[model samples]
Target: MVRVLAFLFLVTAALALDPLPPERIQALAAYSNAHGGHALLIRQNGKTLHESYSNGHTQNEPHRIYSGTKAFWCLTAFAAEKDGLFKLDDHVADTITEWQSDQRRSKITIRQLLDFTSGLEPLFGLHQNDFKDRAAAALKAPLVGTTGKSFIYGPASLQVYHELLKRKLREKEQTPIRYLERKVLGPLDLGPQRYLPDPKGTPLLAAGFMQTALQWSELGSWLLKHEEIVSAFKPGNVNRAFGFGIWNNHAAESKSAREVDVEDTLDKKWHAQSWGNACLCRSAPADLIACLGSYGQRLYIVPSQKLVIVRLAKDSKPNDAQMLRLLFANTR
Candidate 1:
């Protein structure tokens, strides 16, 4: 009986997840504040471990997440697949019949578009709220690289995806945004957003979302429970660090892995960008994955630790590798 009790105690202790020490948490907050961060929220082991606000910001104010919006929209694709709408491997040209004539565009799959490997031009103009009829512009965007071989991160592929999803959901008399609200947002308890739609009513899929730290953390927390979204973490052929609107640190395990400043590199022209074996932070756990947006907005998840962190800011971006290194520093 004594031996059995000892074994049970060991198992329980091993399963328990302790909170990070106060000093480490304080350091992380200080790091965030130094980089213009307005809000910081952290959750671990199914509990709220830390929460703070700076820059005269309050918890009630929503901050623009910019590209972090992609992560939420990408969830709609997985949810659609679950609803028997369409598979990720399905060709986008199947729904956007206008592209059937283009040899390169016709062969592009939904996965390729979501993974930013569809070879579409990075049509950043669509990000502007006044750029009316974004879907039309995306359909006419030319292929600038080899399909499935280039990682062109921009609004064009996502706009194409929006058009495709819009057509597929038409039979049910549903819009893609509504489908997303019903399938993804509703479940996470995230209500309506600004969406930053063009005059023709197409939301900017690449950027434009305003969310508070607590609100964005909800997505990261929900991510841990849904096994179906595993596809979101799988890397594409060209960009090993990114897939389905989120970036992963899995490459940190490799000896040759290089920590790249994601925002700065993404700003480079596609031909100039080099994304091979990129790591967010070499010192952080390999399981660390993040939803990053312009101006230092970040929602980071370390599944192995049951951890979720949200940082919101504007006009200034922090170093991802440095912030993540601070988060996990000295924590084994």
Candidate 2:
């Protein structure tokens, strides 16, 4: 584990990579702007290289990041593990006692939930802002496949994980929102997000975060400076493309790697989606990780280059591979 250091010194010492040159930023921003993108911000080694906003978007204005919100919740899972709440592989049924009676559900682990491979039905309805008691609803979701052998990407797995976390925190006399506020958001200096709490006051864990481009980059910066981030990118058994609430370009190194517009693939029914050998962009470095949301919200983190780039937009026209190729093509 890398000794926790303020990013200033950490960037200077651990990552000797230089910031993106001026023309690179211009090219990246141009590509983004031409494709309905409203904001493009780039940071490297704890310093802002360039920040741009257009089309009525401002630096401070917040926009919905959608499932990009999952990465933040996943941070809570790691924090809980650090606090000895439970191991990532621990059976979730241990905390959600009612699950113990369900064979497949009882076998699900904490890591499975974060990775979206717990076999729980995707339950897309959980994304609705008014959906009530998401945790309870997720608990009732049945297995769509063998536990640990399926990648059912949706809000259900995360809601169940949240329920388990809530139970674990109760033993410590804490609440989930406070734990997230203190353990995750506070460190990033981000304020309370639009969690969209249900009638039961249980905040939706799968999505509903709204962050400005600059604000979203804060998480990317933290990830670049965190020494243990490599582990967080570990691909799951069911989905080689997703890991711990983040998507990776590890498959970019493969000859069979398919350049995928993730939002399109996710639009298909979970059973219809084929995630095998999916790579965001073959031209990008294999270490690249992304938090992608609907309608082209993006946070691209390249640990190898000590870089973090945020691209926020209104609609889903921006091309991921082309956008990344534009930036990396201008790299020194």
Candidate 3:
């Protein structure tokens, strides 16, 4: 792909793209103050930057990345793949004994789990149950759609996959948390973190992950460089096809969110891909910039523009369209 020098040059060049002026910084500050607080425009190399803000918190503070945990789990999957613990085609039922008796589940593979096509029926209305019970009930649940056919964007399939993987690894005397600590977090020098395990004492692989924006940025930057993370997945021949579990964020037009409200125009333009589990991530403006500097949320290596863009907000009301348009136009 793109050479490392080319990527670095692009990042350096992009930082010069209209550095947030005093007025804009003030506006962002005001915005952050109004909504708890925020950080802004913290730049690293083209591969990393930091934009963080909080109402009462400041930089280096911990926040619930919500479903951003999905991306983190994706990283774990990469680690697993790189270690050759399991192949993408490995059968989920084979990995988890409970599912083997169920013929439908026997057909499910790790690839299907990553693509949200496992067809596992969802276990709803168990917010009261601890993580373990919730996961157990989900495993016993029935299948709805045929495996690898319907794209049911829900939690049931992933939850089951997490439990299965956790069990499989645990049998080998491994756990997701340990795997992440030794393989991912530790490798990146990111530690002093926590991940809640299910009642059965397994890392909630599909969810229950927490980290600061800085930690998130570290993972994001790694992806932007096409470093070890993406190397785990053999890239698919299809441009936007899901390879392993990670979505390739190569272009703005390849996402599904672009058509969120504009159904009539869905075919006219592709939408932004959804980073499931975690929705749009939350961080200060600066942390987000670092992520964008390396194409954090987009998960692509765009050395030509040397630009990464990230927006973190509880709601999309403040309007990112105008700001992103301006940013892209100036950079181009």
lDDT tens digits, residues 14-76, model 2? 567765668767888877787788898888767788888988888889989988999899899
Candidates in order, TM-scores: namely 0.94, 0.93, 0.67
Model 3 lDDT-worst window of ten: 286-295
Question: Which runs of model 2 end up more than 4 angstroms from their true locations?
Answer: 1-21, 330-332
Best-fitting candidate, measured by lDDT? 1
Candidate 1 at residue 174, lDDT?
Answer: 99
Q: After superposition, which runs of candidate 3 have C-alpha atoms over 4 Å from their true positions?
A: 1-37, 41-54, 124-132, 231-258, 261-312, 316-323, 330-332
Cα lDDT tens digits, model 3, 83-122, are 7778777998777877788778888888777666676654
lDDT of 3 at 203: 46
**Clashes per prediction?**
0, 0, 39
Best prediction by TM-score: 1
| lDDT of each residue in 1-332, candidate 1, tens digit only | 99999999966854786667778789989988877989999898667889999979999899989889999899898889989999999999888888899878889999999999999898888888899799999999989988999999999999999999999989999998898889888998988887888888889888877888888998998997774575456789999999999999988888998999998998799999999889999888888899998889989998777889999986465799888878775564
Candidate 1 Cα misplacement greater than 4 A, ranges: 1-15, 330-332
